[model samples]
Target chain A: SQQGEEDPQALSIQEGENATMNCSYKTSINNLQWYRQNSGRGLVHLILIRSNEREKHSGRLRVTLDTSKKSSSLLITASRAADTASYFCAFFSGGYNKLIFGAGTRLAVHP
Target chain B: GAGVSQSPRYKVAKRGQDVALRCDPISGHVSLFWYQQALGQGPEFLTYFQNEAQLDKSGLPSDRFFAERPEGSVSTLKIQRTQQEDSAVYLCASSLAPGGFDSPLHFGNGTRLTVT
Candidate 1:
């Protein structure tokens, strides 16, 4: 499957704590993107890190990409209750113009 | 500006029936995509369109599924002989970029289709 695998199918953290999620893919990619999906809602784009970039940041979110490892990670700092959502990693390969998403990591941030 | 919009927020269809889902992309967005997401799973790419041209549909599961964007602004996904396995949420997303991976996508709330 072209789909990537996300580490820790689920995670729980306090409102003020930080949460991290990892994703590993099999093929080379043009860029990797992270999305957050609230229950019963469509996904919202969080951040994107190109294969050539080692890290990128957006507000409280941080993303890292390691092309050699074929892996990427997303970190949420000072997570809030609203941060509770399923986080998915999607990689766009040159071969496939569309993004392939992982199963996702379900996160629960307790207030 | 309005975001992507998908009609019939919810639908219930009996097995063997045909169903059509509609998506209205963000105005002037050059790229649109359709995805199928099962319960507790990530969205799976179904098809992609650049303007009115269907550039890639390699992710479509079978011939039972068909999608079109004739005028390049609105799109429709039609499922023929719907089966129980076809029960899933259909999501539509549009990007400002033409056909590359550089831009982020704006997604609709999605239409939840239940096949019984």
Candidate 2:
């Protein structure tokens, strides 16, 4: 079974706008990571935030984690058409070396 | 430097037939992984390998699924007696050894397997 579930299965925004996607997981985890997939290709790693860290930032991307709530969110600022893709949140359970993913949020950025 | 790469970007297999998918990880990468992704779902873990050792394969759906990395650089995933339910995109990823909170995985384009 999948450990996490993402909110707002799909999102659409214009260029330069911001987009946010939420994810909720069911179990204790060591860390959470976000990835992006373009078209029908492979996923590209976006960012990872450890359980000890509440938030992280990478350029136009920002991620927040709340273990108490077992939830996480990904924010993209100044979005571009290039950022149009499906975003997924993968959870790494405590001591399990394997990462489980949520259903994912599909984002569309209109130019 | 080359990122991870997979062979036969697309494949069509008849039900009950066997199919092999290959992955070539980035040079010197030590941790390799395979995943299955349905049309609208996130990729699910299928297996993990550390060098030539198969450390974890708990995610494999059934005994018909097998994977191996003979020399630590290239890996292969084989499915015996494929079923219609087996149709999906198969992705391969690799990371540096002793992966931690920051070891970002590099992924391949994936093989789109269509089982009829």
Candidate 3:
């Protein structure tokens, strides 16, 4: 079963605007990681936020994690046409080797 | 570095037929994983391997699905009887380190399997 659930099943925005996506999960997690997938392509690791860490950044991608609420968010600044893709949040269940992924949020950046 | 590699980019099988998908992970990588992605959905965990050992396979949907990594490098996922519900993209990933919750996975493009 999917442990994480991303809000806003789909998002459409201007090329230069910022896009924010939210995710909520059940149970405690060792870490929450975000991934990006283009149409018909495999997943690309974005950023990982450990349970103890509140926030992290990679390039223009910022991720925030709130363990108390079992929620997380991903912010893409200055989105470009290239940023159009489906984004997913995966949870690392403590002691498990596999990651439980959410359905994902599809983002479309129109130029 | 060359990332994880998967073979038979596309496959078509009739219902009840057997099919095999192959994965060639990065050389010397200790962890290999398999995932299934349905249309419009994220990749779901199928199984995990640590070298030659079949460590975790709790994500496998049923007994008809089998996976093996005999030599600690190349892995194969086999489906005993193809079903329409089994049609999805099978993704292969590899991590350099063990399943220590630290290393990130590198994914391959995946093989699209269609069951008719």
Prediction-by-prediction clash tally: 0, 0, 0
Off by over 4 Å in 2: B99-101
Candidate 3 or 1, higher DockQ: 3
Who wins the DockQ comparison? 3
Give lDDT tens digits, candidate 1, residues A21-100. Answer: 99999888888899999999998999888878999999999999999999999999999999999999997754545888
Name the DockQ score for candidate 3.
0.73
Native-to-model Cα distance after best TM-score fit, residue B40 in candidate 2, in Å: 0.5
Clashes of 3: 0
Two-chain DockQ for each candidate model: 0.69, 0.68, 0.73
Give a tens-digit lDDT track for model 3, residues A16-111. Answer: 899999999998988888989999888888988999999999999999999999999999999999999999998876456878899999999999
Write the residue-wise lDDT of candidate 2 on B1-116 in tens digits. Answer: 57999988999999999999999999998889899999999999888888888988988999999999999889999999999999999999999854423588889999999999
lDDT of each residue in B35-108, candidate 1, tens digit only:
99998999999899999999999989999999999999999999999999999999999998887478898899
**Pairs of residues clashing in candidate 1:** none
